[model samples]
Target: MLEIHQFPCLSDNYGYLLHDPDSGETACIDTPDAAAYLHAAQEREWQITQIWNTHWHPDHAGGNEAIKAATGCTVLAPEIDAERIPAVDRIVKHGETVWLGEWDAAVIGVGGHTNGHVAYHLPDAEMAFVGDALFALGCGRMFEGTAPQFWTSLTRLKALPPATMLYCAHEYTASNARFALHADPDNAELQTYAEEIRHRRDAGQPTVPSKLLRELKTNPFLRADNPELQARWGHPGDAVATFAALRAAKDTF
Candidate 1:
């Protein structure tokens, strides 16, 4: 079976280490802090064999070279952003597959946060290491992609199995929940989910690894296509426009 070790790093960033016990192969989901990742792997007695980068942001790929030098692990990055990332042993594009031990992770192009961002989906595990493309009750800022492009990217994620567990890269749920309530105030589901998030944060617990179904019902960004949201946001029948408006509002919220 595959195991995941999630730890906090770089303030709010959540670092992930994907380990396959049978093969003793471990992959760092992203290199936010090399030391933290290395230490986590060492504590688990797992050998680092691969580094899978979802995007080229400094916070996401900043520790690639150090980690690779220390462990001799091959680095896999998005084809479109390989030049921006360090020590990339391979550049993978959308629809490509990468492996760890006997498990295969499909590369999904989810480029709204960044033009080249990708998500790793392990079907058998029913989980995805989504980097910053998505967050609980929210998503990444539209940094490099357009509203239409971002909407399309989100659509792909929405089509995933409803039970798929999303391992997003940040501990931004509490803040995201605040903005979600502001954006979709009448959404009872969101109201309840926000309350739950509040309790989770107060308890010093992680609010990541959010299930897709709950997000679909509560996340305003993911519900841009919903008739109520589209009408309320004044972009009836236009999911992209609704998404753009919601994103713009969140930026300043």
Candidate 2:
């Protein structure tokens, strides 16, 4: 089993440190803040052996050099955005497997947020580190790809095991929940989930690592194909069009 640590960084971003106890191998997933990652590692007496970056966004890969300098860790990044990521010791392609100690994680290409964005899925761990592709009740903006591309990316994510735990890069759940309510106002599950999220935030707790099952029910972005949502939005039965409409609405929401 892997021991994972989640910590806040760079105002709203979250840094994940995944440790494999059997081999004492620790990997930092994305680098929102290099100092924060270093501090967390030092505090736990763990040496960071690897860095798995999901994209080339500054906030996600900003600390690559610093972290590698500090720990001499091998930096692995998506092959598609290799130019943007610094200090990338290795390039990982989609459908390829990367090893973390004795465990392996499959790299899934999830573009749209960034044309080359990728997510790491460890089946044994039942966890996925989705950079900016998917989020709680929301999804990454179409900054580098089209709505259809983002929709396809999200579809792949939704196909993960229902029990999979999604570790998103940011804490945008509260705001996403508000927008989700706007799109799916009559969804009782969303209403309940929003209330719970409100309480958690009010108490200064993290609402991340949301369950795939829960997101499937409450996240509007993921429910674009739902008959009720399509009808409410006056969208034809096309999933791509439905997703495009909702994504456009979210851009301004």
Candidate 3:
């Protein structure tokens, strides 16, 4: 089985550690700090064989060189932004797959947060490492990809298996939940989940890897077609447009 671990690095940023227990090999996803990555590798006694970069943002790719230097690990990232990332051992394009020990993951291009942002999907495992594309209840602030691209990216994610575990790169769920409740106050699912999240956070725990089905039901970003949100926000022409308005409201929220 593939064991997934979360290493919260550099404030809210998260660097994921995926280990194939049988192989004793680990893959680091978006190492924000080299020292922390090295510490994890040493502590786990797992060989750091590969590093996956989801985007070119420093918070996401800053430690590429440092981690590679320390562990001799391969840095694999989107082909389009390969030049921007130092020590990119492999430039993976859409449809390309990478092997983390014996397991495999498909590379999916998600260019809303950044021009070359990519997400990794392990379909059989029903898991995805989404870098700023889709958050727990919100989505990434548009930086490089346009509203259309961002919407498209999220739609793709929503189409995944409902039980798929979404591992986002930031810890923004609590704040996102606040906005979600405001947008859909009577959503019983949202209210219950929010309370649970509040308790988890109060107890000093991280809120992440939320199930996609839960997001589909409660996250406004995923509820573009919900008549209530559209009625409250003034309906837009399309699903993407409606989602954009909700996102804009969330920016101020």
Give candidate 1's TM-score: 0.99
lDDT of 3 by residue, 184-241 (tens): 8889999999999999999989889899999999998888877777777788446777
Number of the candidate with higher lDDT, 2 or 3:
2
Q: Rank the candidates by TM-score, best first.
A: 1, 2, 3
Q: Which candidate tops lDDT? A: 1
Clashes of each: 0, 0, 0
Write one digit per residue (lDDT tens) for candidate 2, span 1-253: 8999999999899999999989999999999899999999999988899999999999999999999998999999999888999999999988999999999999999999899999999999899999889999999998999888888899999999999999999999999999999999999999999999999999999999999999999999999889989988888687888888999998998
Which 10-residue window in model 1 sums to the lowest lDDT? 126-135
**TM-score comparison, 1 vs 3, better candidate:** 1
Tell me which residue pairs clash in candidate 2: none
Each model's lDDT: 0.95, 0.94, 0.86
User: lDDT: which is higher, 1 or 2?
Assistant: 1
Residue 174, model 3: lDDT of 94
Report the alpha-carbon TM-score of model 2 versus the true structure.
0.98
Q: lDDT score, residue 116, model 3?
A: 85
